[model samples]
Target: MTDTDWGELAQHWLDRLADCSVPGAGVTRLPFTPEHRRALGVLTELMEEAGLVVRLDAAGTLIGRLGGPESAPALLMGSHQDSVREGGAYDGIMGVVLPVLALMKLRHDEVTLPFAVEVLAFADEEGVRFPSALMGPRALAGTFDMATLDLHDSDGITLRRAMEEFGLNPDSLPDLKRNPTQVLGWVEIHLEQGPVLESAGLNIGIVTGICGIERHMVTLTGKAAHAGTVPMHLRNDALAGAAELTLATETLAHETDGLLATVGALHVRPGVVNAVPGEVSLTLEIRALNDALRECAGAAITHTARDIATRRGLSLDIARTYAQGATTCSSKSIEHLCKAVATGSRSEVRRLVSGATHDTSAMAELCSVGMVFTACRDGISHHPSELVSEKAMTAGIQTLEQYLIQLQ
Candidate 1:
């Protein structure tokens, strides 16, 4: 198939899934939801039509396989299917579609590789429904904590219940663990999700590493008082303390190079217009390509929160919810990706550190992994405005197809 043919196919698949999302809003295919299942069904059909054998794992991860020599370790590719609430369509979907189309193009050309290739559409990389990210890949890596089965969503649905409702048995998740020796490596073709590639005037980027992430839940408590009666000097306000800590987080991240800290969620109570907030709860997320930097930032933020609470006479508590170390792509896989980009484009293939985490970060625990990033419009991602040009998509597919051929 020609580039035009592949581009049209990609657009067709994207548009098909687009209907599963809320109209005029961004994509919201949360894990195990009806929309997510519908999207997976569409993708499964497309994969089968591409001449791949398709199956669904116990964790609801979709896998499409192409054969190689018997006893040869297979190469894994693709990304997650679930999106953050009202998120863009291309963030995770592009990774899955590109590989399927690349394989289809290979089949059309009658080319066969010596190593098997498996396309993975992970179930819950966004963690929008669950409290943690990378759930799907973590399950396959045998790192999924069974305790998370009790974790509840906004609708009061436990992860285990959600799995069962979606036709997956949580007890069977252990069976999905992949044998390390049976998998050669993983390669994900994702959108850059940032403007680095576009700024560098390149159509694609080879990811050097994924950022480490630390997530925390912070709560500040104080005595509730009447808003009008409480004197500024006498008041102990949890909301005020939280605000100070939030600004401190932003300041520290700005002062520290390559560190990013965000207070994405906040809640205040008694949540009344006439009452001074007695408690404030917020989520803190720290990320950096360097592990040391990430740790330092987390420590600094924690210290700042404590200091703010002490000054305000409010009690402070911090609970770490998640922590993931930085991950570097394997050297051999990087070499293969670079060669693929060189063969497909005249522009220099740039190596970049991803500020955002991906399913490949979890897969790195199972086997060697690498990633290719197509430039997205501006630096936008996880939003409705996220997009990639048709030309860039075509380039990504060509590069991926060439990379797969090199694996033979």
Candidate 2:
């Protein structure tokens, strides 16, 4: 197959997986769900068609392997199969589909690399159903905590129970851990998910590092009162306090360079038209390429929320739900990615930090990791409108093909 054929194949698979979503809505393939299972089955078939041997690890991560020398460690590629609720088509899926296309092209050309190539469709990278992200990569890295198995979802279904219902054995997760020496390196091709590349009028770029992320669940408590009876000055409104904190968080993130803060989920108790809110619960997240910057921003947000609650005659509480450190790509891997981009396009290779987290952030713990970024339409993702041009997709596939061939 030619380079154009690879791009067409990538688009074909993307369109296929997209059919699993609700009509007019974005993709919603959460881990272990029926849609997710169907997507995996389709992907497995594609892997087999591409001349790769496919299997599932204990965590349900799909692995499609292309053989190489027996003595060399394998090179890992691909990304997660699952996505956040209403996520765009290209977020995680592009990383998986593009590499598989590249592998298929290599097979068509009768070329084999020095190290084995394994295309991985990680089970849960969005963590929408679970409290933690990187479940599959964490398992491969041997960093998954057994206690997390007891964690419950909104429906009160424990992780272990959900796995069992899905026909997986949680007890066997430990046995699937990959030795550090078993992987030569890992490479992922993902959409920029931001406008950096598009703004620069570039088709592809190299990732410098992934930002640190911190998540929190915050609550404000106040006395409930009749909306009509209570004067605005006399009301102790938890929702009001929460609103002020949310704006404060936005301001803090804006003032700090490269910092991103979002209050995505909010809940108000006694959600009635005539009742003053007695309690408010919200989720806050902070992302920064620097650990110190991330921590400082998080602390400032918490402090501002506390002050708002106190002045509003409400009580405040904050619970940290998740934390992951910033990760830099290996220097050698970056060099290879740069060379790969140079071979595929005339565009200058650029480097930028990713504000969004990826499974590669966790895989960095297991082996050397690198990332290639294709430009999205408007740096828009996690929404139905997310898009990348065919030109960009072609550039990405060509770059990936060059990178894998060079590794041989």
Candidate 3:
């Protein structure tokens, strides 16, 4: 296929994948759902059309393999197929499609390599369905915690039960761990999910690393009282304290370099407008490529929240819900990806740290990992407005194919 055709195919497949979502504004193909099953069917057909042997692993990772020689350590490339709640079409799915198209182009050309190639469609990365995300990569890396199987989702379904319902034996998860020595490194093609590339007028970039993430689940306690009867000064309002903390976090992020602080979720109790909100629950998320910076920002947010609660006569309860340390990409992999992009674009490839976590972070534990990023519109992602142009995708496929050829 020509470059233009590759781009067209990437976009077409993305549109089809988007349709395998809940009837909503954006894609919502969570792991183990009917939509996920439908998407698997579509992907399986495409993988087979590219002349690959396919299988869904015990961890629910859909893999497509192109054989090389006997006992050869295969070069793995892929991304997750799952989407966040109402997330954009390209966020996770594009990573899976771009590599498939690259392999298709290679197969069309009848190019043979010394090393086997495998494209992986990881089942979960967004942690939307279950709090314990990155199941597929971690399981493959042999880092999966069996205890997480008991974790429940919104509908009270355990992770183990979900896997069982999906026709996967939960007992087989441990056996799915791969031998790192027999495996080549992992390369993930993903959207930049930021404005750096677009601002720099570049179509592609290389990832330096995945940022560390920490989430704070906070609750402020105050007395619930009648909104009309209680005077503003006398009422201990938890929502007011939460509002103050939110602004404080925003200011901290703005002031600190390399720090990203967001109060993405907030819930007010006794939700009725007429009732003075006596209790509030909120989530404070902190991220940074530097672990020290992330920790410092998180500490600052905690201090700020505590102060807000104390000054407002409200009690504060804070718990750490999630913590993932930063992960640097393989230096060799970055050089290889950059060389390919530089060859394709006839210019330098931009390099940036991914503020958002990815399956690559989990995959890194299994093997050396690298990532190539395509530009997204206005640096938006995980939203309905997120977009990547066909031209950009075409460039992405070409880059991946060249990288594969060069790797061989």
Candidate 4:
């Protein structure tokens, strides 16, 4: 009935995160897997225990509702439950637990919101399965389409097929899209997943916008040769061309302010020790809060790749994986969240932008959206070491609770 009890509830969710087996890690709870469903089942039980009505949609997004006055639209809060392989316990799960606990705290206070409050346990935000992020929110926003479902996972099963196996109807996905008129606003309490808050000695961060992402796959083609027979000076190696282009991208991204680029995956044809590679493929991900800046940065990288390939006597092919435009949160909702934080704690809340993608980006197109961030240990996330202290999590919950109640 007290805040301590709500804190305890948060801890219970943390424990579930540790035990849920969705992927390779003890902490990861991947979406659509049996383990993921089991975790969602546990979440349903918790929400029901807290007096919320629970339902799982056709796309597997779990919703918990606390009804309020009929005149006000719903106050929505929640985060994804899926985790990256071998990822940390907090990442997406923190967003899920805090809001639920905050709702519990409110109910204990005998407080009824002026508007209904719904907590969502998003099925997939990590994109660890399909490589396209923000699945749950996309479905809710009507942004995720059949083309998205047609993509194959690592196991060669299309996303639609996987959804069918999990008892979700992919064909009815359009129905899952939310009507902006039914929802008032969205707020997500997530770990910062970066060092800014911790390094600044801050407890919470208010997100301003979600950054745009430009993902591309680059392929280099050249003549393969016997390693012993062809000298480096005479041979045209696709792998070498790829290496040059990768470094060029890195250098250009660094030169551009606020730009981030990474070559995360790579493969070489005829992967043998004795043969020079005839073909090389690599993936590049570039992101920034400014879409124009991101586009310029991407173009620079592409130009560099072409120049490097030409000099190396290799052919280059580049294709976009996905490009998400930057999205800004509603200013009114942000003011509410900041005021709540300031009232709940003495800490000064600063406006920050999310370097990563979230479901809120999708929701922003349709309704007012905002975010709350707790300090991640060393700003590290998506790994086993990602952590946030109990005190910090409690602070975040209190602030979010105040925000939700004030929204009434």
Candidate 5:
């Protein structure tokens, strides 16, 4: 038995964390800012109350460590502390609080974990202020690119300078790389950020893997002509080509087994009522749990777009902008989580793949990674309306604590 006032504690802690944000409608805690510092203060209190030793890593990742038996590797938990501007209260921070509360519940029940546990509040995950993200997890995984330190924020502050001002030694970030041998695994509990779980009438779901993502910047060029003077046959409109390509991408996704493609942004040149569009640019993104599937679709869409351009007498340029391979949750981790789910819920664990990225993807480079997706209201996220019920929070805490107890 435990004294768990789930809604009260979580809601109160979330309120306190929300208050640490800048003056805004939703929480606006960016890394290395006053809001981040204030929220860390609150987390420190929670960590201390849970009987853990707290410290901040060189990259500003706030870590709370709970020791295990001698020579045991640590099981890393928690999520990012920062948020997008006017973002939801529970996006990243809830993952941090729920784990600490799980530890607190274990302590209250006199339950001790067999392996070392660490609650990590990563400094930046949203990349809202900077052009790069996943600094903490990537550093720990030894996959961090040192050149990113030179990247500048909106205010012209270099990441290196911001780290220095935040009392962190940027030079030591590489030194903070976690040894694979010293880490048991990593688990992140976060809002579903999608409607899958909510639509299923479930509060929690186990992640099968994180989708691989790729983006291409596409440009189409054609001659601009007077709309009234040039007939449709004579006009080589770039916007028309772009429209065809967008539909092609959509059709490709719809026909494919697992691919999800989008023309998320588009721009037209020579804005005028009379002039024909001269040029067009857009972003084409494809995501899938299978890298082969994603890459295949990307190739197909690119080829189709090029053909469309040639037929219309338009020139096209497509450049790959970003690519991250898909990451699958370890079978061992899935087995353990299944057992944990049996401990708390009657229904079988619902397994799903995440279309969006998370810190778990980066941590996979260091050790095995798993995720628990807590359903949010109407699957809304990255906005102020994000909501996770206290009942769901309590269920998550129970399962996480059981996970610690059930780990082999």
Candidate 6:
């Protein structure tokens, strides 16, 4: 059904996203911004053109409805369109556009469903305005209440105010959360955001789970002294302790096999050319597919940091900032997706786990959730140099269309 004209649809949406920008191609479409509204308008028009009755939920989530028999729960598909500042073309836009294109192709072929289908173009999944991510799905799951909305961004802009600017109400959002029994399943088509698919020569991957995340902040304290006066053995340096801890984190991850850890941020108090630093702070991020391994890896990292500090005459402090449990995709939903891909392309399919977090984790709280990933060249994403093969995009659309048909 999507053979000839689907590429045209993809190009149309890609152009739409590209056009809603300044002279430079930066997508500053943060929630409540003028750019965000224009992008949503384009999405609404496209949904209507594809013959779906569309509406915006109380949380400003764009919904497109294709009606069917009244008995079965609806099968939901699609993703977000908002991008991080200057993010790649595919990250959020393709996820929503490809599914819509698939549905449009099905409609063109006169294909109907035994159950209703709704395509969602969620807003603010990146949490650009706030530190908390997955705003749209959290509200839909009834997990984000007024209390969460009360939190403010760096500019002191509350989510409630942001929602109001976009014509939504924070208090009335509970009504928009889907009843668990009313949703058959949820699916998001996204870029792999990594190199696995491209390296393995695969067209797509059926996601089995989204990894858990552990964010920590570590501080090392020592006496500040003149660099030239303090002898090497007598001097206690916080930066030295921090450097040893950073190296230990890498070793810990390798020891745990599946564990992934990084010290992405660091700050040395009184950053100067000729001074012994008195304090050092760094952020530690750890991820794993399994909870037990995640915890064990974290312990190893902390222990190593402490040992290094003790030997160097510095004191260590570690604080837990945030932690999210791992989320697994439903086996039944994954099998269904696998079959859909096989039917569409007749190619061998790969089942993989996502190393990155997504809005799918929030949806999984209310319904079975699965994802499809088109490869990004060199396994890179969230950057301007990001790339995805046109062929993989086409195959991804075909797989989604077939998946929707089988959902009946």
TM-scores of the candidates in the order shown: 0.89, 0.88, 0.91, 0.90, 0.98, 0.96
lDDT for each of the candidates? 0.89, 0.88, 0.90, 0.85, 0.91, 0.83
Q: How far is candidate 4 from the true structure (C-alpha RMSD, Å)?
A: 2.6
TM-score of 3: 0.91
Clashes by residue pair, model 5: none
How does residue 395 of candidate 2 score in lDDT?
A: 91
Model 6, 105-181: lDDT tens per residue? 88887898788888888887887777767777888888875677888888898888888877877778778788889
Model 2 Cα displacement at 249 (Å)? Answer: 2.3
**Which parts of model 3 have CA positions greater than 4 angstroms off?**
222-237, 269-277
Best by lDDT: 5
Model 5, residue 258: displacement in angstroms?
1.3
Candidate 4, 73-113: lDDT as tens digits: 88789998888888888887788888888888887777877
Model 5 regions more than 4 Å off: 1-4
List candidate 1 segments past 4 Å from native: 22-24, 221-240, 269-279, 311-313
Candidate 1 lowest-lDDT run of ten:
15-24
- Sliding window of 10 residues with minimal summed lDDT for model 4: 1-10
Q: What lDDT score goes with residue 376 in model 1?
A: 89
Residues 1-408, model 3: lDDT tens digits: 567888889888889989999998888899999999999998998899888899999989999998989999998889999998888999888998988888898878888888999999999999888988989899999999999999989999999999999999989899989999988899998999889999898899999899999998999999899988998889999898889999999998999898888889988899997998989999989999999999988887888888888899999999888999999999999998899998876666899999888999998999999998999899999998899999889889888888888987
lDDT for 374 in candidate 5 is 86
Over all chains combined, what TM-score does candidate 1 have? Answer: 0.89
**Superior candidate under lDDT, 4 versus 6:** 4
Cα displacement (Å) at residue 70, model 4: 1.6
Mark the 10 consecutive residues where model 2 has the least summed lDDT. 1-10
Worst 10 residues of 6 by lDDT: 20-29
